[model samples]
Structure formats: structure tokens, C-alpha cells
Target: MLDCFHDECGVAAVYGNPEAANHVYLALYAQQHRGQESAGIASCFPGDDFIIRKGQGLVSEIFDQSQLALLKGTIAVGHNRYSTSGKAILENAQPFVIQYRYGRLALAHNGNLVNSDELRAMLEHRGAIFRTTNDSEVLLHLIAHCNEPDFISVLRSVMSQVRGAFSIVLSDGERVYGLRDALGIRPLVLGELEEGFVMASETCALDLIGARFIREIAPGELLIIDGKGYESVQLLPKLPRTAHCIFEHIYFARPDSYLFGHWVHDVRKEMGRQLARESHIEADVVIPVPDSGIIATLGYSQESGIPFELGLIRNHYVGRTFIEPKQSIRHFGVKIKLNPVKSILDGKRVVVIDDSIVRGTTSRKIIKMIRDAGASEVHLRIASPPTICPCFYGVDTPTRSELIAHNHTVEQICTYVTADSLAYLSHEGMFNAAGGGGETFCSACFDGKYPVEFSGMDT
Candidate 1:
């Protein structure tokens, strides 16, 4: 659903490609689905200073041929952002560039810092100036003020102090660095480019740039690329348990990407299969909500022995519908993005498959649209379990009071959406579909068992 929770950000970097900025731009474009609020690229040459260009817009809107031509370097880092911590402003865009004792550094971060307020206050008291309210700026101050003698030591010291999910990419005019938090609540992967090494939030970005897939950057791992190629360092002792965010498999990640060693598309399809087994209903046709639901809908149709049809068509050209006329129109917001296929739904009992439902408003509008198109019955099947709590790590989620699932039972939700029936995949079913036991992934949004304690922070 377009009204669903938003992902944090996407990070992309190249260590040795001469046209590093161009490659990073392509990678960010491929991972644009992760975040759309802002886009940026920071490049560094061997002897030259960091070249940075960032703005509050899409990659295509921010960078043109001339802009790319100006960013000359063999090392680059880029970010696509949807704010989870900082305000939506130009200064909050990444990769944030700074000059410290070590040298010029550019950093792009994905995920929220639970202790950012505490860290920021400490830094401020010590006379550290901040240019942006972004939690990412705290890292720069931490690294700059550390008493450690070397870059690697300073990074390790800084990582040990911060808490919460962080998958970061940093460059110091020549070398590129990648790091993941101890719990690995966010995703980051390493890839091999023809000219050098690449790192991104997802493998889809690497595929777009024709890079070979390398393994995921392990939890608490630090990867550095310089003249000596890539060097991996274990920054912290492996935690007893890791909190791999389960939502990545259910939503956030691109279907083409591999996350947690499983192809995202395969996991989603399995979730649909599991949903079919858990809740089987006889229907004339199975239809997906389009885009996000396409793979899962296919699995639902296959497992249930029902024919799958394109019952909804989405307008690819429409950017997010952020505005509506003061004079209300019937389902005006949804109508701008999606239209139902009358011939396919006419007089048929349709099973509608969707990834998840945040609030009942969007689902209700979609169901009503199907009904108006002449559908006899509308049965809603969600591939993932209901999201009952807000996520603090990275995802921008509605408060618990705003969540329909948190406030209403499944039967009540069915009534609220005016669907003939509604069913969501069970927590166990989701775990199985994701190819990991319950212990391996974080299901805090579904079960309210946060792996990391935010304490006084407002999530």
C-alpha cells in the first residue's frame, strides 16, 4: 500500500571505478524504491578533496550530465534517503561531507540511532558544532573527537558507543569503508566490480551495474578498501543473537535482491504459499494489488489452484499522490495511482493479495474499487502477519494508535475494509517463509519483542 510504512535509506559506494560517481548514481537509481525523499553522491579522488552534490529530490532530478561530469574520482559513496531521524531538508541529505583531523570524510548511513539524542548532547557540550539534525552527523563528531591514534581504531571506538541499527558507508578521499551494527538490523552487501569493490544496501544495485555478488557484510564487521584492495575486520565480538530485520524479506527490499542469504522474491512467494495453506478460500480468481503483491499473488494462485488475473492496473507515471483537491472526490488519491480491470473482476469472486495493511483506509478504497468494478466477492489475503507496532530501527511507521491491526482484530479489520473475508500469514508461517527460525530474525513489529531497547526515545 502507498500509505504503508516507509523504508529508511539506501547506500551505494564504489572504491576503485574511475567513473565512480556515475556508477554510484546508477546503483542508487536501482535502489530508489528504498527511499525517495532525497538523493546524493560524494566522490573522492586520490589527491583531490571530496566532491559532494546532494539535494532533496530523486537522483534524476538532482544530478544531470554536467553535475556527474563535475564529480571526478575513483572512490564514491551515495545515498537515497527517506528520513527516519532527521528532518526533510537539504542539509539532512547524504552523503554528509566533513573535514576533520584525519582528512576529508563523506558518510552515508541507513538506519536510526536510538542513542542519538544522548550522543548529540554530549558532543554539543564539548563544543562540537553540528550542521544538520541528522543522527548521521553524530558519527562524524564521534570519529573526529576520539582519542584513538588511527582511523580504524577511531571507527571501532565510535561503533562501540552507538546503539541501534546502522549500515554505513564512509570514504576518506581515497579509501571506502563499510560497517554494520552488531545486531545487523539493516541489510548491506558487498559486491565485486570490474574495476574495484562495491557495497550497497541490496544486491539489486550491484546487478544493475553488472557487478558480481559478494557475501553480505557480516554483523559487527568493518570492510575497508584502499590500494591494498578489500580488508575485512571484525570490529566487535559476535553477539549471542542477531536481530536481522524480518521486514526486509516481507517489504522494504527489492524483490530482485538477495537478503539474509535468501532471494527476496523467493521468500515473498513462499510467504504467499504459506498464507494459502493457512487460509484457503474458494474464489473464481486471484488478483494482486499490483507491484509489491505480484510475486506473492502468483504463489497464492498456484497453491490454491485458482487462476491469476490482472484485476488492477497501476499508473507507472504517477509520482506519490501527496496532494488532493479541497473538494473531495471518491477515492481520488487511489484513483490517481490504480484503476481496477472491470472485465476481469466483473461477476467473479476475487481473492486480493497484498503484502501488508497499515491503516484500513487504503485497503478499503481498493476493495470498494473492486466492488464497483462488479466483483461478486472480495477476499483479502496478506502475505505477512499484521504489523502491530511501530519500528524504531529504520522504517518510518505510524504510531500504534494509528495502526489498524494494532487496534482491531482480524474479523474487525475484515468488517472495516468491507471485505468478504480477510486473513494474514501467521508469525510462524512468516518465519518459515523467510528461511530462518524465529531466533534469527527480528519480528518486533509483529510481536512487540524489540531486540534493542530504545529506553527513553520516542519511536
Candidate 2:
């Protein structure tokens, strides 16, 4: 079963590479964890018509050898989308391509725009026809309708209208561009490929294509790359305080990635160590909830001096949709997705480490499964603080009323999850271990301090 929190999106672009589309496919595959809803790629040689391919499926399911071969070009841009602002439909699949005065433009965006509703209404009033419900499309409209003298000027004008988290990659058939919001609420990095340059949502995408990590795109920086080379311009001024999404370290990003000026794996391990220090229980063995929880579990085991064990195994082949029989099946899907190791958990005082508890339903079900597998005592340790608020940036989360921690105390959550003891990493521990002060990162999901105010937007 997937966690309650949904990932934002992933983006990649390659310029000056003969196999630009192929490299982008590999990049999207590496970032499949970030999104599974839809995938797309657009490519073109300098002064050529763009070839665009998009589908409502996984990256592997959407593209194959023939499709990649047909996307012949030395420049490309790709996106893997998990929509937070739009309905799931073919119309909403990204790499949103359009023909305008500048010829062809394709854009893929990875964050939510808080003022998109107001902007959309304004645009519609001005006879702007809309295609998809996603806020990302608004960027394309803004760029197309700008009265600026040049492309850079157009970008600066558009950046002023949109407000919120955005890490976007776009192509105009000849060049590739990458940019992040002024507050830097998301991750975007540049990489050096042997034949070209790469920009993607994470360094892991670069690693998969054998590209060398260069550096993270600075907040408000816009990077433009073409056959000649690449250059950067600060289209938007840096705010007094930057707000990098902290969930990237806790659960959203791949552990192998380096994000927000720190190694994601190192930051996660530190969170686990800090959790161990905050809440310690006498237990026989420490077991992780599998995959996402494994790294932090190592740190917990190291600090707690408890032997680390892989008590839960996950099946990765599960898709977003599953057919149910006429009769409802109880615990069948959960078992198929994650199964506990009886040998490791039987007759032992087991401590289970997980990323975070959202609705508490999955955590409850998992705890029940562990007990059924013969664990005598189960203590649950969460790697991050309780999610008490909704994220307005990019994460798809339940409302505040739906979040268990919003209404219940720690003792109540423990009882609801049916755990002997439950503990979450403190907010201070998480921020400190992540190596930043409150001004450097966004903890809106934890503390409800939104860096970008909703009602304050220009109307």
C-alpha cells in the first residue's frame, strides 16, 4: 500500500546530446518513485519540429524502443507527473506542447502555484482559452501573451505573476531551460553529461544516465542551455528566507540524491539517530517497514544498539489500479504489498521504524499484521514528526480534518495504531538533523507556517 502523502513530480531535460530522448527516458525511470500517474517526453533538433509523446501510465509502459527512436533529436525535455492540482486525465498529462509565435514550446512543471486560480480567471476573462486544469498550463499562457522584448524578459514577467513552489524544465525545440521558484520550495539540479548538459528534479536521475552532478540550481535562478553552452540569470530576487521542502529528506526524495545542499541519505540517517535519542525503548530487534524506511532504520539500529533486521518485504510491481472481486477481500492487498517475516518478529520485542503516519489506517493495519505474525510486543518509531497540517505547495495530502495527528494526541495515536508504544521524531530534531534553521526550509506540513500565503495574493 502506498503512503498517504503523494509525491509532487519529476522533470529532466537534455541539450546537445544526440540521444537526448533516450537519456531523458532513463532519467524518468530513475525518478519513477516521485510520480507514477503519467509520463511524457518532447524532443527536437535545432530548427526542427518538436516530436511529443505522452500517456497516462508509467514511464516504462508509455515508451519503448520504437517511440524513443522516433523522438530523434539532440535536445529534449521530459516529465513524470503526479498531479496535485489537476484531475487524472490524458488532457492533464504534461510536457504541455503548444504552437505560438515562437514556433513550438513544451513545458513540464513540478510544483503548485497558489495564485493559479486567480490568474486563470483573469486570463479567461481576457479570452484566453484553457486546455488542462493544471496550474502549469498557466505558465505557458503567461509566456505566450507577454509583451516583453525577449525570451528572458518574458520569463521575468511570468515569474512575477505565479507564486509558489515550481521547478520547471522546458524546451523550444532548439534549447532547454530550467528554473526554480524564488523561495526554492522544491529541488532542481544541473548535471554534466559527456555530450551535453542535463537538468532534472534530482541527482538520482543524473546518476542513472551516468551524468556528473554539477550543482543545485540556486533559488530564483533560470538556466538556459543550447548547443553553444549554458548560462544562468536571476530572473527573481532571492527572498530573505529560503524555504526548501523538508519532506524531501523525510520521505519524498530518493535517499541516494543530494538535495537542498545536503546528502539525502545522510540527512535521513541523522533523523533516525535523532529519533532514537528522543525516544528509546528496550527492544530485542529493530525492523524497518522496507525500502523507504531501511536507511533511517540503520541509523536507529546504530544509535539504539539494536540489531537491524529486514522484517518487512515489499512487492514493487503493484500498480495504481487494482480490480476487486464482487466480495471485498480483507488484508489480502496489504499482504501482497508488504509481508512481515515471522522468523525475525516471532516471540521478540520488535521496534518498527517507518517514515511517518498520516491517516493512521495503514500504520494500524501494518501493526496488526505484525502482531498476527507472532510479534509479542511492537513499538513503532516514526522517522519524521507527525503530519499535522496539509501542504499547499505540491504534495497531495489529506485535509487537516483528515490528518490523525491534527485531532489526536500521541497517546491517542498509539492506541489507534494498536502499538504498545509509538513515538515520532520531534520537529526540532528533524530540522536540526536536516542541518537548517526554520528560515531555510519549509515545515508547513508540520507547523502550518506557509511561506506563500494564499489569501494575500493579488486579486
Per-residue C-alpha lDDT of model 2 across residues 301-350, encoded as one tens digit per residue: 99999999989889877767777676776777677689898999999999
Clashing pairs in 2: none
Candidate 1 structure lDDT: 0.92
The residue ranges of model 2 lying beyond 4 angstroms of the native Cα positions read 325-327, 456-459
Candidate 1 residue lDDT tens string, 359-414: 88999999999999999999999998998999989889998889899979999999
Question: How high is each candidate's TM-score?
Answer: 0.98, 0.97
lDDT of each: 0.92, 0.91
Error (Å) of candidate 1 at residue 352 is 0.5
lDDT against true structure, model 2:
0.91
Given candidate 2, what's the lDDT at residue 301?
Answer: 95
